[model samples]
Target: MSNHQNPTHSIELTREATNRYVARNAAGVEVTFGRGEDLMSPVELLLAAIAGCSSIDVDTVTSRSSEPTEFKVEASGNKIAEENGGSHLEDLNLSFNLSFPDDEGGRKAAGLVDRLVKLSHDKYCTVSRTVEHGTPVAFETEISVGREEDGNKDTE
Candidate 1:
């Protein structure tokens, strides 16, 4: 017999309705995703992930110097439609707003902010690295038919 180690991180997503899904992490944190303005779409989540990853890197370094009063990140991108009935995000950008205490320590930390941000994009942020390197992603899907009360019926 052979023992195999599972992937370190994974999320489970359940489709709740049309274009709506609930994704759950190992710690039971749940996020709701939907197609319309009522919820975050997949594209929005991608942008958020990129911004969040970088923000985490910057925040981690800044916190060691001084207590940050505020940290905000805005992520945006353009979705380009492809000829094969698909779309992709292009021109991804993230705007960061950071605030620190009005003191000498804060000033010192502020001086390092830009360098930290650059370091984050260059080396620290995994999401940014994956996007930049054009990493190939593979998916495995399983279909379960004739389940009970799944909100849809198979006419077979």
Candidate 2:
């Protein structure tokens, strides 16, 4: 695949506390996250991303037939911390539940969701594809240290 074909998403974070951060996405949407009980953990966000990506695919196809009366997705996963550092999700599970009107159009939409979900898991959803393929992540870090008298100094 061409690198140019890939979509890039960015997140900016502001430190609110030692374990708290306000994360903002490329679209200026902000999400507060931390180690606190009330905040969404990083692992939860990962599962959410996976489920959301697939749900959007199914929703698009289902909506083409008829509007869904209700839609919901529940995602869960087991996180195993590595001996060195970081962690990975295992046994990922996603349950998709949706409702539609009790009519022919609704029945067609309902069936469409199932087909679209299979398509998403097989090819359409980027998040699912990345997870299934073990896509390599290249990391680059740049540090800027500025002083009152001196301008910004960059170090990598």
Candidate 3:
């Protein structure tokens, strides 16, 4: 079997309040989310993540010809609950509404929108690809009462 190396991406989520959390990445960038009218819920974040991932992929290719006047990607899906108390998203979609200038470069960019979107959906967007493929997620728990006073570990 051939083994392919894959880069790791991760974020640490810290609870701020009831049903609220702040997700921090390796770069220390953080985003807070919760279930409130003024905040975004986990389900909303999932939709945003899907759009953001595909936007990055499509933007990289489309902008090569010309900058778009309007670049928007709206992701939506219906959450369905089954009889066994399991829930999942269905009819998930990512709609791109883009507009370019009227000149040659703009025309070139506009021309690539359809193909680029397809390319992104089919291969480039990692978030959607993972969801579509039903990637297995392994969960684990740790009982770390406290961190060591000093950054040292003695494995005796």
Candidate 4:
């Protein structure tokens, strides 16, 4: 999908109790819940949304280039009390590590990282864009090639 286009995704949530819910995405991915018990804390969910969106964009862009690729994305952010009675999330940081087929593949993969971030922060990734408007968000990416011993390559 192009950055100029926004795809619609539907999320269905069933409230299990006060501050507790079970949510499912359009793809039938099921997520169970509790207020702060499960992995669905508000902040955690937001980070997940951002990570998911960016990862999808990167995968799509890289796959279209006909290069074999695999990726794992992990995101974390800290919230500091706002000064002057403002909103929470004073600062947010997101880090991504992308593993490619080889050194050149790593470089090419890295090249797409920024584009993914831009698409997410500027045009797509509704969750990231929405959160960024309220707080300062920073992103960092690292790219590396998967080693043959990493069980990522076929051996003959």
| 1-156 per-residue lDDT for model 4 (tens digits) | 554645765688778778888889888897776566454786677778788877777777876544546567787776766677754554566666666666665677667777777776677776777776665657676444654655574444
Query: Which digits, one per residue and each the tens of the lDDT, describe model 3 over residues 82-105?
Result: 999999899999888999999998
lDDT of 3 at 40: 93
What order do candidates take by TM-score, descending? 3, 1, 2, 4
Clashes of each: 0, 0, 0, 0
Model 3, runs deviating above 4 Å: 1-3, 144-156
Scanning candidate 1 in windows of ten residues, the lowest lDDT window is: 147-156
Among all candidates shown, the one with the greatest TM-score: 3
Model 2 / residue 29 / CA error / Å: 1.5
Worst 10 residues of 3 by lDDT: 147-156
- lDDT (tens digit, per residue) of candidate 1 on 7-91: 7778999999999999999999999997977999888898999999999898888888888898899999998999999988889
| RMSD in order of candidates | 4.9, 3.0, 3.3, 17.9
Model 4 CA deviation exceeding 4 Å by range: 1-10, 17-19, 25-29, 36-38, 66-70, 82-87, 103-107, 134-156
The TM-score obtained by model 1 is 0.84
TM-scores, in order shown?
0.84, 0.83, 0.88, 0.60
* Residue 27 local lDDT, model 4: 83
lDDT of each: 0.88, 0.86, 0.88, 0.70
lDDT for residue 71 in candidate 3, whole number 0-100: 90
Clash pairs detected, candidate 3: none
